[model samples]
Target: MACAWEESTKIRDVLIRPGTENDCNTIMDLIRELASFQGYPYAPQITAEILRRDGFGDNQQASFQTLLAVDRTTDKIIGYAVFFPFYSTWRGKGMFLEDLYVKPAHRKLGIGKLLLAHVSKRTLDSGGCQLRLSVLKTNPAKMFYSSLGFDNLTVDDGWETGRLDTNALEHLLESSGLTRS
Candidate 1:
């Protein structure tokens, strides 16, 4: 839960583990940090309540999974990844990695790689054949991902990305003419 610290080569004792309901607040904080780093200080609106309700609710309606990397010495969660399953018409079941971030000070310590490896394994174990994520054009992590053999959809596969923000989403829904009975 704090900003990245100074970078060093010293040994970093870190542990990657499944995120629990108790971690919702910390996870949300880390997500805010990530948004600020990505040049969208006010982009993330997720709250701990939403996280707990959606991810750990009794109704079993969660849509995503989270894994956190904690610094063993400090017991602080310095990194995390959020992902979920999706169906692809061409590839069948797939996993979509929504976010992958490591504290600036915690970068280059192989924590990101370990997190990604865990997600990849989880995807395979869940009978998924594809893993997808979106990276910002200005982000330097693109190189790291490239080194890991991830293809750039735009360059490698000629795929373009699109999205609908909250306003557009509301407009679309209103225009769709669908309503509850």
Candidate 2:
């Protein structure tokens, strides 16, 4: 399915286009860069093969979609955004942006904003009513998102994010006597 922005969009020599299996390696590299920028304690467990399988493999198994921003002059990927459709009982259809990153050299050039605009456009085109994302409190991008009208739900609605790592999930399943068929 073509996104709303079917044609590759160029902003100051950067071309934004849909990501394909061929771009998985470059996308993995950008994912690592984003992990480093976020000061992740451990390296990301995702690999190009994983991205290719889960994102570009069988239609029923594909979990997400990606948009890549390439540097026109160098023909290299400089940024990417990963997103997927979701449903919210209260808000109806929505799009969740999993990651948005631009190479350090490309910051402050409106690339991030352009990427977001494309995501927003995609969300609206897909019958989604809202776009949502989570950002670390310490990340400077929080300010950028705020400037772009993203609300800090933690403050606005007192919502606390929760998570369960693999180990915790395993423990829950075992202790609860839940069996996966």
Candidate 3:
């Protein structure tokens, strides 16, 4: 099985280091490619320019916390995980794993698990109360996350996720109707 193969290859020692500005392009490509694998395909609207500006930008709306895994032999970036901290009213502070992707060829090598372990350790190191993440209902990666000991927090009633499109966003802004003096 591909999953088994990915896991086995990942078992080998790999370094999980923090991502830097130099890694922006590679991370962007990986993000785009990984998104395509999950069915979406296109140049990421999040450009290298944007990555450099916002992620490492001047004012720093927020900071990007990423872990990059490098393959020893080829010295190529094989996997990455990005996460950030969040405030949980119910649980105080918690960390969110925003993205985790490992190249197919370098998978089964324990990269995914190691990536998770790295995040878990970082989360604990930061004095966070919990590690939280979201998964698409159709995403099979849920199995891998669950296998990593992350339990689902299901609400009793139906709690569905929702999002607003560009049109709706414009409508909301217009309705609120901010005007210059």
Candidate 4:
């Protein structure tokens, strides 16, 4: 597969920027491409409408923030990264990089590295203590993450990550009659 372009067909002044309302579509396209590459493409039921509502809707409080690497001339996005804040209980506040995807066709042109540096810089700017991410144990991404200075959190496989959703928490609160008067 051809790697990243040294110079695009015409889009040379590529820019990496924070996601904006105008980029919602481009971001979704990248997300789909990444998911497809990972072999899970979107679930059978999801749609573009759901993506906008869940991810870009006002008042949405999802943990992740998205960034884009775009080619200015052709206006084609080459890659993206998404990350979020996390609490370490002991390590205190940190960042969890939830997704980092560089289209295979655009790999190795420093886009991935630049995207990571962008994340690390933002983490420090936000007062985060450290940056962390999880990768499939068998995936080659561990190498990329390690090169970026992420120490593999070698916790004994005994402790697995936990997840909870707003709806679940709401149910618990209602069942306990803990709503504020």
Query: For residues 68-156, what per-residue lDDT tens digits would candidate 1 score against the true structure?
Result: 98888889998999999989998899899999999998777778988898999999999999899999989898899989988888977
Tell me how candidate 1 scores on lDDT.
0.87
Better structure of 3 and 4 per lDDT? 3
TM-score of each: 0.87, 0.89, 0.83, 0.74
Candidates ranked by lDDT: 2, 1, 3, 4
Residue 25 deviation, candidate 2, in Å? 0.8
Number of clashing residue pairs in every model? 0, 0, 14, 0
Error of 1 at 140 (Å): 0.4
Number of clashing residue pairs, candidate 1? 0
- The sequence of per-residue lDDT tens digits that candidate 4 reaches over residues 1-181 is 2333433432346578887656767777777876777676773355556656666778867536878888676678888988888888887887888788888877756778778888888998988889877776766777887776766655544546668888998898999989946
TM-score preference between candidates 3 and 4, better one: 3
Tell me, what's the RMSD of every candidate?
A: 5.0, 5.8, 3.7, 4.6
Model 3 scores worst on lDDT over the 10 consecutive residues at 153-162
lDDT of each residue in 38-136, candidate 3, tens digit only: 787774688877877767766756566889998877778888988999788878887998889998887656778888888999998998989988776
Q: What's the lDDT for all of these models? A: 0.87, 0.89, 0.81, 0.74
Give stretches of model 4 more than 4 Å off. 1-12, 42-46, 60-63, 154-158, 162-181
Worst 10 residues of 1 by lDDT: 1-10
lDDT of 3 at 150: 69
Q: Show the colliding residue pairs in model 4.
A: none
